[model samples]
Structure formats: C-alpha cells, structure tokens
Target chain A: MVPINEMKSKCRFAIILGVTLAIGNFFRVPYAFSEPIVFIANDSVPMDSITRKELKDIYTGKTKLWGNGDKIVLTFLKQTDVYAYFLRNYVNKTPTQFVNYWRNMVFMGKATFIPKSIKEEDKLMEYISSTKGAIGYISSNKLIKGIKVIAVK
Target chain B: MKKNRMIINVVFSILFIYSAEVDAYSSDTVINGFITQGYMKTDENNFLTDTEEGSFEFNEMGIKFSSAISNNLSIGIQFFARDIGDLGNDDITVDWAFADYLFYNWAGIRIGKIKIPHGFYNESRDNGIARTFIFLPQSVYSDPWRDSLLTIKGAGFYGYLYGLSYQLQIGIMDAQTDGGLAKKFNDITKSSIESIQPETAIIFSLQSTDLIDGLKIGGSVSKWDWKMDLTIQDMPAKSDDEALLWAISIEYAKNAFLFSAEYSIFDVETPIDLYVSPTAAPYRLPYATNNVMEGYYGSISYRMTDWFEIGVYHSIFYSNKKDRSGKDNVKYYNWKDYYSWSKDTCLTFRFDLNQNWIFKLEGHYNDGFYNGYITDNIDKDGNEDVEQYWYLFAAKLMYAF
Candidate 1:
C-alpha cells in the first residue's frame, strides 16, 4: 500500500545499507588493514636509528653483536600486523620464509637462539625495557615509555 | 636385521628420555623430528626398489636435539634412520653431532660429526618438510652415494667474510660400499667387494646472500681419496682412487614462487696398473680409465594457496660425460642401450594438511637407466637389461614438529 516513489526510495536505502554493512565487515579484521610498525630498543642502547639493511642483518642473525661489542638480543611479536609489516618491509621476506630461514639457521649451527616470540604487548615492552641490547617492534600507536624508539632509515 | 631393529628401539627410547630431560631444563631447547613414509612404483624397471609391483620400502625418520650450553656455544645431535628399498636397510645411525663455538659473527667453528655443505639443498636433503619435492633432484644427489656424501667426521670452519658466507671442512670419511656401488662392481667383475674407505677428504663452499633479496648463489668443491679391497674370481685385489666433485647452484624465491638450478660433476681417477691382473696377460680390466659423472637440473615451484603447492623439474644425468651418446660404453661393456645416462622429468604436488603434517604426490617420466644397480633391474641371466623409457609414481606422507 505504499506509494511507488516511496517504495523506490526505500529500496535504494536498503541497497546502500547492505553495501555499507558488507564494507564494514570487510574492514572489521584488524590485520586486513595495514598499520605502521615502529622498532624499539632498550634505553641503555646508545643507538637511536638503524638502516633497513642493518635491521635485516640483525633479524637474520647476520649481525649478532652491537657496535659496542655487546651481544644483540632479539625479540619478536608472534604473528601480529606489526610483525607481518616488519617482516615484509625490513626483512624483505614473507612470514613463512622468515620462519624457514630461522629454522635453517638454528639447525645448521649458524645461530644459537631464535628471536623470543612474545604474544602480549606489555610483556614485549617490559622485556625490551629491562634487557640491554634488546630490539623488537610493535604497532606505532602501542609505543610505551621506558623504551627507546629506533627510527628506520 | 633383528639387531638393527633392537638398535632402533634403543635409540628411540634414549631420544625420548633425552627430550624429556631437556624440556625440563630449559624451554629454549628444541627437539625436532620428522617421519616420512613413501611408496614408489615403475612401469618395467625397479626404479628405487623392487617397484615393478609397487613397493613400500621407502621410509625415513629422524630426531634431533639442539641446546645452548652457554651464551656463545651450542651443541646439537641428530639420529636418523631410513629404509629406501634396500639401501638404508632400517639401520639407525648418528647422522650428525656437533658443538659450535661462535667467537664472532665473522668467525665460528664447529667440531664433531658435521653435515657436509655441498650443493644448495644437501644440508636439508633429508628434511622432506623443507623441500618442494619428496625426492630431491637425483642427478646431483644420487641416492646410491648418499652415505658417502651425507656427513664428515671432523671439524668445519664457517663464517662470513666481506658479505660472503663460507664453510671449509677437512675430514676423513669411512665410505662403505655395502650398497648399490658394491653390487654394481660385483656384477661387473664377479667379485665380492667388502667396503670402500676414504683416507682423506676436503670440502669448501661459498655463498653470497647480500647481492639480492631472496636470492642465493653458491658453489662447492670436494675431493677425496678412497681405497677398496675386493675379490675377483676368488682372488683378492686392492685398488685406490681419487675423486673430485664440484657443483654450482643458484636459487631465487619471490613471494609464492621459487626457482632453483644446480650443475655438478664427479670425476674419478685410478692407476691403470691397479686394474691389471697380475697373472693374466692383459694388465687392465675392461673399464674406462677416467670415470666422469655429470648432471644438472632446474626446477620451478608455485604456491597456489597457503595449503597447496605444485612444482616441476627437469633433471639430466650422464654417467660418463665423454660418452653422452652411451653407445661407446654399451659397445665396450655389452650393457643396455640406456645405461650411461638418465633424463628425468617430474611433476609434484604438495598438500599442507596442517602445521605439522604434509602429504606429497609425485610423477616422473624417465628415459635411460643409470640406477639399474640400485633398483636391482638385473635380468634372469645376470645381465644389465632394463627398459629404456619408464614412468615412476611416488607418494609420501610426512610429519614434523
């Protein structure tokens, strides 16, 4: 019993609402959306910034010692958006490739330890803050106090 | 065989206890293991087993433990067992045990039984989970010669220099000829060969990883001297020979695609006097003076999805590079038509059932017969006769953690 014009407008509104809901569902997954990754280090470390190549070398166990001859401690977040971003950009490798590389390194006696994988952001931040020569990454917005930010050059 | 089974049981028991102990001590300790069971069959010839009627003799299992004893020192050991047709025979053996000391990033030393770094895939050859194919390219990594090339009992110096990673190993290997090589020699000379032992061996390899992202180019060279004692027509004979092996490899991986290629040559030289019969008129056996084996293969793989992958490769091997046509050797030795080379084209499919399990199916179209001894493809009249062209199908299930 509705007018033809009103029915057409209601139909249009329903279609728009359906499309909006679909888009919302698509973006609801946080990992589907890209986010910037920020590298953090212990405050005791003198270094402020690291080049992309150096960062790659560090994560791959190529550069094991810091400039001051302290053993470099590596930590990582377990399969987060920031971890994926770091692996893709800084390491220039996919997550699977990075995992395989580390496994090979460990089994071949090229490395002694894989980077410590932390699931909680608070634990990662605390580990970075307490350990000397430690390096890790988190989302840019999750930067915490007591840890120094390392600018990626 | 019972003794071998007993040894396997004991080894597994020890491994379980050790794994538990290590787990209790530190969570950092990693205990990784893999088990793969495979089936293979050929149309006419017995390719890697008595596979004329589909064989299930191909199996591999391994366990390893790695622990960091100190900040800069770590120790690792692996126990492995394999039964590939009749080659491995279900014998449990210590694959590798090493202690590594890292003085610096540019310098490290590994002491103990160390895995030899040969071609690009030799180090991880046994780990089916890490490779695209159930069987690696047999051209460069011949199944018959695995024990000789698997590991060395000595120390190796591995480090990075000027952006180049290098490893040098000087060791002595006790190469056993209880496998196909012995059978081949016995078939040729009507003799029983006990073993072939290497007095000395050296291996050197170098790789460059910084030149390109996800690209690795490397080369390796190995030299060894071996001595063998055999009975020819119930008479004892001794011989010594020197072998030289070298290979070049290139691999590139980008996103979901991977490409790899390797070429290798193996050369053996023996004194003509060693082949001569002391009591006979002629001083030399009917064997070629210089024996050269060469091969190359190229492969490409694509990951269609997170759980599925497909790959194909073409591998060619020549038992004697100088006689590519295989006519000269056949005429001289009165062997089969395709005895001097093998051309293998293979297709493979891999399914990642889960994070810890994998299943693989592979098909191969092969032309020529270089592995008749390993496959036991001898005719009833005790002659080397096999089909020139054949097909092989293989399936493997693997689990790793």
Candidate 2:
C-alpha cells in the first residue's frame, strides 16, 4: 500500500507525461502547423509576388501562361501531410478533390499538363532549380538556395 | 473481323506517332484513361435502351494522351468507345484531338477536333467519375443529340476577359440519321430518313467564375444548317432546315453542397414536301411546320462525407414550347398518342469506394410519353405503345485514373 501523497504524485506524473506526448506528436510533423512557402525558379521567373487567387488559378490550370508568354510549369510535393495542408489552405479543396479536378480536366481535353509530383524535398528543389518556368511550394523551414521565395498576397 | 483489324491498326499508328513525338519532347508527357459500365431498367417504357427487361449494354471507355511541344504550344488526343444499346455499337472513334497555342494568359487558340462548348456539364459529360449522378439531367442533355453535338471539326478561340471565360467555335459537321432526333422525326412523319448532311455550325459560350468563390453563370448559343432526305413507302422527299439552340446555366459549389440550374430552347425552321404512294394518291401533301423544343432542370447535391454523396433533380421537357399541352399536337396531327412534354424527377446516390473506383445508383419517376427514342419501346407495327407514367432504376460502376 502506498501513501496518499505518493499516489497523488504518481497520478500527476502520468497525466503530465501523456500531455507531453500528445503535444510532441502534434508538432512532430512540421506540416501540421507550418505554413507552406511558395517558390519559383530564381533565374527564369521574374515575378516576385502572386495573389492567392492567381495562385489558385495557376494550380487549377485556369492560368496556363505567364505574363511573358512562358508556360507555367507546376511542381508539387507528394508528401501527404504537406500536400493536404497546402491544398486545404491555398486551393480551398481536399487533396483527393484537387486530384480529381485535374483528372477530369485532362480527360476532358481541357488541360495538357499535370503537375509533377516529387516525394523528396531535395528532388523537388532540384527540379525547380533546373527547369525554366517552374514553380513549387515547400514547408516554411525547408527553404533552400537557388529558389526565389514569392509572397502570396 | 474488319472492325477489329481497323481498331488494331489505328491503335498501333497512334502509339507509333505518339512515341516518336514523346522522344522529341520527353519532359512532359502524360497518359490517362477511364472505364465505366452501367445497368438500367424501366418499369414500362424503354428510356435509352431495352431497359424494360433490364439491360447492361451501356459502357464507356476512353484513353487520352497529352504532351507539350513548346513553352506555349501543347497537343492532346483522346480515343473513346461506348455502347449505349444500339447506338455506339462498341465503335472506337477519335473523341478529340487538338493543338492548343497560348498567345497570352487571357487568350488562346485550339485547332482540330474540339469539344463543343454548351452547358456547364456538356464538355465533361463523358467523365462519369467526376459527376455526382450516373445520368445527367436528360431534359437538357437529350440522349438523341449526344452524337450530333459531341464535337466539331474546326477551330476555336478561347480566352478570359474581365474575369469572364469565353469560347467561340466555327466548324463543319456531318449529321447521322440513326440517332434519337432522327427517330423522333420519323415517328412524327411516318417516314424513314435515309441521310442527313450538315452544312455548317457555330457555337459561342461565355461563363463568369469570379462573381462568387464557387459560383458560375454562363450562356451558350449554337446554330447549324442541315439537309435531310427521307423515303416514305418508295416515295422520296428532301428537306432543308436551320436549327438554333441556346441555353442559360448557373451553378454554385461550396463546401459540401452543390446547386445548378439550366434552361434551353431549340428552334427549327424546315420546309417539308410530302407525297403518298402511286396507288394511294398522286396529289402533293402539305405538312410543313416550324418546331421548337424547350427544357429546364434544377438540381441540388450534398456530400455527406468524403466517400458518400446524394443528389436530386427535377427536369421538364417540351417538344413544342408553344403547345405546353398536348391538345394542339393531337388536334393538328389527328393523332391520339401524341404527348407534348415530359416531367422527370430523379434521386441519385454515389459512393466513392476508393480513390480510383466509384459506384452510383439512381431512380427516376417520369410522366408523359416523350421518351420514345429507344426503339425497343416502339411496337413492331410502327406504333408506339407507351404508358403515361413510369419508373426507372440505374446503377453504374466506374474506374478512373
């Protein structure tokens, strides 16, 4: 048999441990809380900022060409967490819904290109850096060299 | 065997050309396709097929490929096959093949076979998995007009101006008389149409998507000229006509709810010449008249969850808007089986079994005898045996990628 004070102390410790674990789990995935950062090819793209609506239009294939008559190449991170977060906030759609929209567009002969999806952050960055007219998004903390961070108005 | 050989040859030729083009621009090439199969049955009348005894002869399959040739030019092609009872007969044909060139963010041009820009859903009508219902509102999207309005061989100009998207097309079309529209004319005239030749066509559409976050309001107008040749008991006659079709549509989709409405009218002016057999009469008959068809539908859908959705719609169609009641048709034609309109109420449910598979079920309550496009509903004596009221059920399974 334990004393009453010791039992109370043990119970308090267990509660604190559970809370700590929950908080840690919630923040363990950077996508859950971090805002997505928009990026473009530093050398090819001349635009520095884009409106949220313009971004949405570009992602949805509504805006196919940029101002300089260059095609807008789109790239996407395939990680489910970050992709879901970006779709929900930027496009006002779920990941599945966004995919379905593209599929319908492609099948109906409305759009010719589907965004390139890359699983690794490094690979996405590399592709954007190497390709002209390329644009993509990453987590806030994953910003790398050779890519321009554009502000979403 | 001949059809199979032709299909194989076409497939191989497309593959060879596509591969060579891909090798030239290997960076951005994508391929996708879908398959759908459906079953339908009606209690009394055949709707689109032999549905009175239940039928599974409705299926659709398509394959599409697209590639970017340059920064501002891209090309795409799609091959489609379908069997809607006796309509498609499992014929594989070119759905659309176009080369798109973008001059500016606001303007572009597409050359080749292009999809017709009609109502909101007309362009994507073949994509079953993307829609909430297995069958769209039939009043506006009549089955008989599907083949005639699917695509046009010509050029189109598309652009965005002040937040409004517009598409204009000018093309040539060859009309086929085996479709539903021709059948309806035959039923009315008691004649068999041998051929139809389409002279020219033009279509224009304008849609605004920026008024609200998820709202779209649009209108479309299409006009065409056609010449038809008919045979009535060994007597031949020719007729020429001009048809004008126009529609207004509005749709709003936000969150888990979607609402849409559309109204359309088809006006036709034709000169008809009628003649009886030599044994019956040698005198000419006068049966020329102008015709107008009008239809409208309103629908609402709610997504209960990520995987489930339900929708309902009420649609109404009139063979002649001026004569909303059948009294004029019955009196003028001296026919007792004439019906001037159809009113249909439909309920649909959809389940997304997974990301790539979808299942849908639909039920319809119909009133009137306007649904005679399906040949099975007509009697062997060339008479129509149709009930004034009926029920129909349909189910479809689709796999898309």
Per-prediction backbone clash count: 1, 0
Compute DockQ for each candidate against the true complex: 0.08, 0.16
Interface RMSD of each: 12.3, 13.1
Worst 10 residues of 1 chain B by lDDT: B19-28
User: Could you tell me the interface RMSD of model 1?
Assistant: 12.3
Q: Show pairs that collide, candidate 2.
A: none
> Chain A alone, model 2, TM-score?
0.74
Model 1 Cα displacement at B53 (Å)? 1.7
Displacement of residue B287 (Cα, Å) in model 1 is 1.4
User: How would you encode candidate 1's per-residue C-alpha lDDT over B1-401 as one tens digit per residue?
Assistant: 67886787776677666655654223266776667789998887887678898989998878777877765688888788888776778877788889988777778889898888889888887676657798788899887677778888988998875568889998887466776556555644456776677787899999887577778899999998877777666566666778899999998977666889999998977432333456765355547557789999888776654466677777889888988878777776666657788877777888777656789999887777785563376688876558877889999998664
- Model 2, A139: alpha-carbon shift in Å? 2.5
Superposed Cα deviation of residue B48, candidate 1 (Å): 2.2
Q: In model 2 chain B, which range of ten residues has the least summed lDDT?
A: B18-27
